[model samples]
Target: MMNDEVIKLIENRRSIRSFEERPLDPEVLDKLKRLTLRCPTGGRFSVIEIVDQSKKDKLCALCENQVMISRAPGVWLFLSDMERFYSWMKEKKCAENFGESLNKPGIGTFHLGMQDAIIAAQNAVIAAEAMGMHSCFVGDIIENYEEIQAMFNLPKYAVPACLLIFGYAKSIPTSPLTSRPEPEYVFMKDGYKHQSVDECEKMYEKNTVSFRERGVLPFDNTGSYIEWYYRKKYTSDWMAEMSRSVGVFLDRWLSDEA
Candidate 1:
């Protein structure tokens, strides 16, 4: 049934930040969990679900004090769980549980957990879209990683990867399908070839034209447009700090398995 649903869902999905105080259906929630597990994972990953309002309340603070996220009907905090797998390894007496040994192509279970969490999170967005829900990703959750992780009291090697917040819509905004580079420009045929400066400039001009047609004011230099968005988005210093913190946490997560 769901295999047939992707076509419509992909066309309609949009990130939504605002929400009303409504809850999602229990059955639908169950379906979401079931299908999420069906997503292909990289390796032994752990599942950490937080559905209670008590937990959701802290998320608002965790999201750099975002005022609106906790109000979302469905939210998820995906973690790359090394500790959980370690416990499972001890219980199951399987090397793969702790993580693949030093002979593997990756950081064994740690990378797999991140992969699985990403797939599951993406699947959640798709499923929610099919159900006529709106969603926004919470990249800012890591801004307060220490307190946020402490709120959940996460164990060692268990860290927040990303968050997804979804809700039923009051009124869908007539938002444009965000401009993106042409598929050929970004998608290489093979290997990691990059677009040249001229190519980048052309793409920038294309976006500028598109923005002006949409009546987005001023029609000034693209750098100003980018900087405007940059200021609004990366206003907090925590973003850069969190990135460094994540690198450390990831290194730690991979250390044992590596």
Candidate 2:
């Protein structure tokens, strides 16, 4: 069984949009940075803590005017950074021994970097919660890769992995926790289990009911909650842009055009 304090902390975690008009305590910020760095990683990750209001405003615009970006007192951008590692290896003559083909980053490197950065970001989230702060993830930060890369002057080996903002919540949330799929459907016994459409609907019944109650489902009886979300988020223009942006960034990372 989970510890009572751990259970309570995980259960209470939620995305916060509204924050009080104040900065984080200096001691808390120091601890937050330390906690973020302590997470496991395959390689080093870079973190950019945004304190400059001008940069925050630009980031807000880049993320499709998510007003919360501007309002949050603590903003951070996490990167799957290989440039620093590559430079170190070069300085130590280790990278030069491998030659260009073996030294340049590949798809595997990118994946590892993303894992390291995202893990660090989650660590920051949990640590912030423990310190009496709230946080929200800004996934749209991946939608404008070129502009963001230019803004931060990122190298080809450093890709944006996650953007997180933290602050003290203005009010406690009263809404129920979002529903999740049943354990049977999520955890397989041995192999992949493919369910029929009816089974899928059954599995998502709780989500459908919750969405309907919150008025998130479409007014016209066009489709189920899953279909509505598929159209609303999965196939949205912003998602397409995110795909395009990431493709561009990947191409640059994989290119040999030093």
Candidate 3:
């Protein structure tokens, strides 16, 4: 079901942050856009490419000052859009109840939209990598919900799902492939399998050690890498801010008045 070229592309793809200071070839960019559109969608979603320097700069700030936003040739924002569908329904004089259902979507609708957006994003990244280009997914696009919505002039049912910045890498990445847990640890047989606290710790220990060795997490004499990681990442200010933003966005996006 898989070929060597496709397998190699998947294996070698990595998140590239440092990009060369240049624009992508117009033809190549156009081809990439076409390839991305071929990705599966649940009948709603849109991809917007941002090339304006002023807008990119504002986006960089909104995304917690990730300099890669400013360095990349262009950024693609994937939106979970129901506005177009709503407009069509209005023009066709759809039933009031049917229109109201779409006007006030629930959590399941959000999940479907987010899944579609992310799937399209992965397709875009893989296509870019195949063409000798690099890309990184910016989940932080959802951090400043209100500001981002206003900046993009998004409609009520349209929400920013994710961002992918694409460009040529300045140099090859030197980092080794990151390790993952064993298949048994993550992949359950037929149904869900809940692990105990100790089991969870064991599964994560390898990654914790690797992070410390790579100097990503400062090593203290205590040698509790997991503890350090939880404090540094899970409990960080940015994580809290992102959580708050998600809640606020959900409230507004799913509101009947939205």
**Best model number under TM-score:** 2
Alpha-carbon TM-score of each model against the true structure: 0.79, 0.93, 0.91
- Assess each prediction's global lDDT (C-alpha) against the native: 0.69, 0.88, 0.82
Which regions of candidate 2 are displaced past 4 Å? 97-102, 219-222
Give me the candidate number with maximum lDDT: 2
What are the candidates' C-alpha RMSDs?
A: 4.4, 1.9, 2.4
- Winner on lDDT between 2 and 3 is 2
Per-residue lDDT over 113-230 for candidate 2, one digit per residue giving the tens place of the 0 to 100 score: 8999999999999988988898999999999998999999999899899999988999978987777788888898889998988988989998888777667777665357788779
Order of candidates by lDDT, top first?
Answer: 2, 3, 1
Comparing 2 with 3 on TM-score, the higher-scoring candidate is 2
Candidate ordering by TM-score (highest first): 2, 3, 1
What is the C-alpha lDDT profile of model 1 across 178-241, one tens digit per residue? 6667777777876988877677667666565665565552435434344444554466477676
Q: Which should have the higher lDDT, number 1 or number 2?
A: 2
